[model samples]
Target: MPTLSMLYNTAIASAFVKILLFPCYRSTDFEVHRNWLAITHSLPLKEWYTSHISEWTLDYPPFFAWLEFTLSWIARLLGFDKAMLDPYNLNYVSTSTIVFQRSSVIVLELVLLYALCAYVRSMPARDQPNAILAAIDIFLSPALLIIDHIHFQYNGFLFGILMWSLVLAQKRETLLKSAALFAALLCFKHIYLYVAPAYFVFLLRTYCLSPSGYRIQFKNSIKLGATVIGIFLLAFGPWIYMGQMPQVFQRLFPFSRGLCHAYWAPNFWAMYAFADRVATFFLPRFGYSLPDAVNSALNGPTRGLVRDTVFTVLPNITPRLTFLITLFFQSLVLIKLFFRPTWRNFVGAVTLCGWLSYLFGWHVHEKAILIVIMPFGLLSLKDRRYLEAFRPLAVAGCISLFPLLFTPAEAPIKYLYTGLWVAILLKFNRAAPVPLKRQFLLTRVNLSYMAGFIPLLIYNGIVHRIVFGDRLEFLPLMLLSAYAAWGIFWSCISLIWLYFTDLD
Candidate 1:
C-alpha cells in the first residue's frame, strides 16, 4: 500500500499544478462567483435569493450563500476592494479580486484532497489498487481541471462533501451520519439532487426498513426523517421564517431556462437534436414541404439558443416529459437497490441515477457530467466491466469539455494534461492484476473512437475557422455534442447491461 507520506506528496504535487493555473483562462463563472461574493456580503438574507443585479443570481442553496458570505470577510481582509462587494458592481475584475477568487478554489480543493486520502485509507489492502487508481484519476481529471480551475466553479469542494457522504454511507453504523451529510450536501448545491433517489432508497431500505424483509422500523424511520428535516430546516429556516420559500425555490429550480443550454450537453437530447437536424435537411429531397412553423421550430436547436427548444422533425419535448424520462430510468436503478440494499449496489445505483439525469434531464450543463463520472470512479473500482465502460465515457466526456476553454493559450494545456492523465490511467490498469480479458475487436473499436477525437478537435479548433468560419459558427459545437453524445450514450447502455448481467 502507498504510505501516507506518498499520498501527501501526491496532493502537494497536484496543488502545485493548480497554483500554476492561477492565471489561466477563466470563464464568466469567475465573475459569477465574484458577483455571488458581493451579493452574499452586501445583501440581507431575504435579498440573497431575490437580488437580480446580475444575470447569474444566487441559484445555489442558502448554505452555499452563507459559505460565500463567510469567504467575503476573508477576501476583504486580504485587501480586496470593498467596492467589488457591491451588488451592482457587474463584471468587476482586479488583481486582488482574481487572487482572492482563484486562491479560494485552490484552498477549498484541499477538502477534496483530504476526502480522497480518507477514502484510500479506508479501503482494504486487496482493494488498494482500485482505490489508488480512482484517487489519481479524480485528482488529475481533465473535467475537474477544466471546470474548476480554468472555467472556475466550486464543484471540487461540493464533490468533496459528496465523497465523504458516500464513504460514510457504506457502513451500517454510519448510515445516519451519511444521511445527515447528504442532506447538508443538497442544501449546499441542489444539483446533487440527481443522485438523491439512490440515497433515499438505500437509506429507506437498509436503515429505516428491514434489508432482508419488508417490515418498517418506526423509530429508525422517524429518527432518519427528523434528522434530514432538521438539516434542511437549518439551511432554510431563516428564509422560511421570513416567508421567502417561494422565492428561494424559484432560484433553486428555474424551469424558465430552456430544454438545452447554449452548448447542448453530450446527452440523449443532443442526439435527438442531431437526428432532427438530419431529418430536416434530407426530408426536403423527398418532396416534403413542411409548414413555416415546423421549420421555425426545427431551426431553433441548430441556432443553439438558450430558450425552450422546439423540434420541427419530432414532437417538442417539454420539461415535464424530460422529468418523466429521468424518473423512469432512475426508478429502474432504485428498484434494484430496494431489493439488494448492499453497499456496492447502492454505489452502482447512485452512478446509474447520475447517468440517467445527465442523459435525459432538461437543461443539463456539460459540467454536470462530473455527477456521473465521479461516482463512476467508485463503481469502476469494483468491476472490470465498469472500468471498460468508464474508459470511453471518460475520454468523450473530457473531450466534450474542450469547448469551454477555447482560448489558444489554454488549449495545449488541456490536451497535454488530459493525455498525461490518460497515460497514467492506462499504465495503472496494465499493472493491476484484474484478469481483464483482451478482446481485439472491443479494443480496436474503443481505440478507433478515441482516435476520432483527433480529427474532431482539428476540425473544431482549426479547420472550421479555415473553411466556413463565422458562417457556420454553430457547426462545430453541434458536431462535438452529437459525437460525444453517441459515445456517452453507448457507455450508458453498456453499464446498464453490466448491471443486469454481471453485478451481483
Candidate 2:
C-alpha cells in the first residue's frame, strides 16, 4: 500500500527536476500567459476578452483567465509587473520572469500530486501499488515535462483538475461529484470539450436515469442539470450579461485556424495528409488531370498554418466533416457505456472519447495525447487485455509528442527521459495473466514496434539533418507523424473492440 508521503515524494522529485529546467527554452506560450496576466490584472473586466494589446490575446475559457488573474497577484508580489505581466513587455526574459512563470507551473502541479495520493488511497489495497506506478508515470511523463516545464503551458495544472475528476469516476457513490468536477474542468479549458460526449453519456445513463430502466431519476437529473448550468453560469455569466458572449465564443472556438495544428498531431488526419502529399506527387505522373488549385497545393500542407488545410489530390477537410467523423466514433463507445453503465466501462468510454477525439478532432495539438494517456492509466491494470491495449498508446503517443520539442537542445531530453520512463513504468504495471500464445504474440508485436523506434529516432534526429540540411525540412515531421499514427489508431480500435465485446 502507498502512503500519501511516498506519492508526494514522487511529486516533489518531479517538481525539483522541473525547476532545473527553468533556464531552458521557453515557447511563445510563456509570453501568452504573461500577456493574459496583464490583461486580467490591468484591464477592466469587460475588456478581458477584447484586449488586443498583444497578439496572444486571451483565447482560453474564463476559468483559465481567472486562474491567470489569481496568479497575477503572486506575480505582482514578486515585483514582475512591469517586466513580466505588462502586455507591452513583449518577450521579456528577466530572472524574475523565469522565477515567477516556471515556479507557478511547479507549484500548480501540486494539484496533480494531491490527485495522485487521493486516487491511490481510493483504490483497494492490492491496486494501490499499481496506482502509485501510474501516478509516477504521469508525473514523469516525457510529454508533460517537455510541454509544461520546457515548452511552457499550464497543461499540468489543467490536467491536475482533470485527474481529480477522474478519481471521482471510480466509485458508485461519487458519480455526481465526478460530473460536477468534469463540468468545472471544461470551464477551465475548452479543450476538454472533445471528451464532453463521454461524460454526457456516462452521467445521463449511469447517474441521471434509473440504473435498472430508462426512467429518469428526477433528483439526480435535476442535480446534474443544476451543476452544468451553474458552472457555465459562473464561467460565462459576466460576458453574457455584458453582451460579449459572442465575442468570447468566437475567441474560445476559433475554427478558422486550420484542420491540423502547425505541428501536425499524429492522428487519422496526419495519415490523411500524408496520403494526400504522396498522391500529389505520384498522381500527376499517371496521366491524371489536375485542377489548378491542386497543382499549386503540392507544398500547402507542409508549408505551415495556412487558412485551409488544402490537399492536392484529395478532398479538402472542413471543420464540420471532422466534427461528424469525431462524433460517429465517439458514439460507438458511448453507446456501449450507455448499455453497460459500469465504472470500468465508464472509464474506458472516457479514454476512447479522449483518444478518438485526439485521433480525429479538428485542430488538435500534439500535447492533447496526454488526455488519452492520463485517463487510460486508470484502466491499464484492469486486465491483461487492458495492459496490452495500453502499451501501444503509451509508446506511440509519447513519440508523437517528440516533434513538439524538436529543438536540438531538448531532443536528448525527450528521447532519453521517455525511454527510461517506458522502461520503468511498463515493467512495473503488471496485469492479470493471459494465454501463453496470446502473450507471446503481444510481446513480439510490442518488441517489433519498439525496436522500429531506434532507427526512426536516430535517422530523424541525426541522419536527416546530415542528409537534407534545411532542404525538405518538413519530411522528418511528416514521417514521424505518420509512423506514430498507426500505433495510435491500433490502440483506439483495440480498446473499442474490448469495450464492445468484453465490457464486464
Candidate 3:
C-alpha cells in the first residue's frame, strides 16, 4: 500500500506540471533539436546515414540520427511542412505549425517518462514500495522532466533506456534482453559510454563468474556479447557496410579545441576556468603587444607571482588534459571497487566516472549532470551506507541547479518548484532508515551551500562592466564546486568521527 507521502508526492507532481504545463513546455533548445530532425528527414537516404554534415544536428551518434530519420519520415507522412521551419525564413513557418511538429517530442518524452517510472517501480522493494516510489518521484520530479521535455533534449530517451537496462539487469531475466537494452542506450547517446564498463562488471559477476570455480562461463558470456553486437550491427551495420564509419564517428565525437561552455556548470572545469582567468590577468610576458614598462614589471620582479599564477591556473587545464586526468582518477576508483565489489562502491565509482567525464570533457552541456546525479542520488537514498555521502551531494546538486532557473529566465515558479522538490526529498529521506538526524555541522553545511551562491550574485551584478565579460556566467558553477568541496570536507570529518565512535 502507498503511504500518504507517496500519494501526496504523486498528486503534487501531477498538479504542479499541469498548472505550469504551458510555461514549462516552451521549446528552448527545440530549435537545435528540430534541426536534427530536419537533417535526417530532409536529406537523401545516403546523406541521412552519412555524418559529414556542417551542422549541430548530424554531430551525434548514428542511432540518434536513425531515430530522427524514422521520426522525420513519420512527420512527412503526416504532411508536416519544411518551408515553415526554414531557419533562413523563420517568418515562413507559422508558430502553430512549428508547435504542432514539436508536440511530437513532448509526446515521445511522455512515453519515455512513463517507462522510466515503471522501471523504477519494478526494482526490488521488499516492503518500502512507497519509499521506492517517493524516492523515484524525488529524482524524476517536475523540475527534471521540465528540463528534459520542455528544454528539448534526448536525455529523456537515454535515461529511459538506462533505467530499463538496470531493471532488466536486476531481474536477471534474460542476458540477451539486458545486453540489448544497454546497447540501445549506447546508441541513444555516446556519453553513455562510461556506463558500458559497469555493464561489463555486472556481466562478469552475474554470468561469467561460475560457482564451481574461477573458470569463466564462456557460453553465457558469448550469448551476452552476441546480443550486444547484434544491436550495434543493426544500428550501425548499414553505414559500416557503405564505408561511412569514419564519417559517422567523426560526426559523433568531434574533439575540437574550444573554450569552456559559454555558461559553466559547477565542477572542476568551471572552478579552474574562474581561477585561470584571474591568474591570467595578474601574470604576464606572453601577450603580443604591451607597453615595455608593463612588460618589464611582469617579466622582472613578479617572477614569483608568475610561478604562483601557474599553480592557480593548473586546475584550469585544457579539456583533453582534464579528460585524461579525470579518466585516470575514475579508472583507479573503478579498479578499487571491482576488487572490493560493494554496491555503494560500485555506484560511487560509476558516478565518479560519469561526473568526471561531464566536468572535464569537451563540448559538455550543464544539463548532462543529470546523467550522473539522478541515478547516483536514487542509489544513495536507497542504501544505508551511502546515506551521508549522498545527502551532501544532494544539497550540492540542488545548488548547482539554481543556474538553470536563472538561465531560463523563469520567474518565481522555478524557485517554488525547486524548493518544493528539495523539501519533498528531505521529507522522504527522514522517514527512511538512517534518517537525516540534525547533527553537528548539518546547519553549517547547508549554510555553506547557500553562501556559495554569493559569488555568483556579485559576478552577475558586475558582468556588464567588463570588456570580455561572460566570466560571470561561470560564477554559479564555481559556487557549486565550492558546495561539493565543502561536502567532501564535511564527509571526511564525519568519517573520522564515525571511526572513533566505532572504537568507543
Poorest stretch of ten by lDDT in candidate 1: 432-441
lDDT by residue (1-504, candidate 2, tens digit) is 555566677777777788788888778888888888888988899999998888889998999999999899877876774556667777677888788889998889888877877788888888777677677777778878888888889877788888888788777688878888889988889988878888888888878788789998999889889988999999999999999998999999888888878878889999999898888778779988777645456446776554568777778889888889889988877888888887778778888888888988888888889899888877776666777788878888888877767567887788778899888756753444452335222656865786687899888888998998998788888888888888888888778877787728
lDDT of 1: 0.85
Off by over 4 Å in 2: 1-5, 291-295, 429-441
Given candidate 1, what's the lDDT at residue 199? 96
Ranking of candidates on TM-score, top first: 1, 2, 3
Using lDDT, give the best candidate's number: 1
Error of 2 at 45 (Å): 0.8
- TM per candidate comes to 0.96, 0.95, 0.76
Runs in model 3 with CA error above 4 Å? 1-28, 49-54, 77-93, 110-127, 130-135, 211-213, 281-320, 340-348, 383-388, 398-409, 435-443, 450-504
Pairwise TM-score winner, candidates 1 and 2 = 1
lDDT of 3 by residue, 1-504 (tens): 554355446645654564444445345365555666666666665676453343344666677877877776776677777553343332233554455445654555454455545555665566356445544554455446556544556565566666655555544555457678778878777788866666676567666766444578898878877888888898888888888888778767665534344345445555565455445555554663333434433432123221211223333245557668767756665565455444444445556667666655665555666666556654554534345554555555554555555544564555566556656655555544563543434644554654565565454434443643653343444445545545533543443333223211
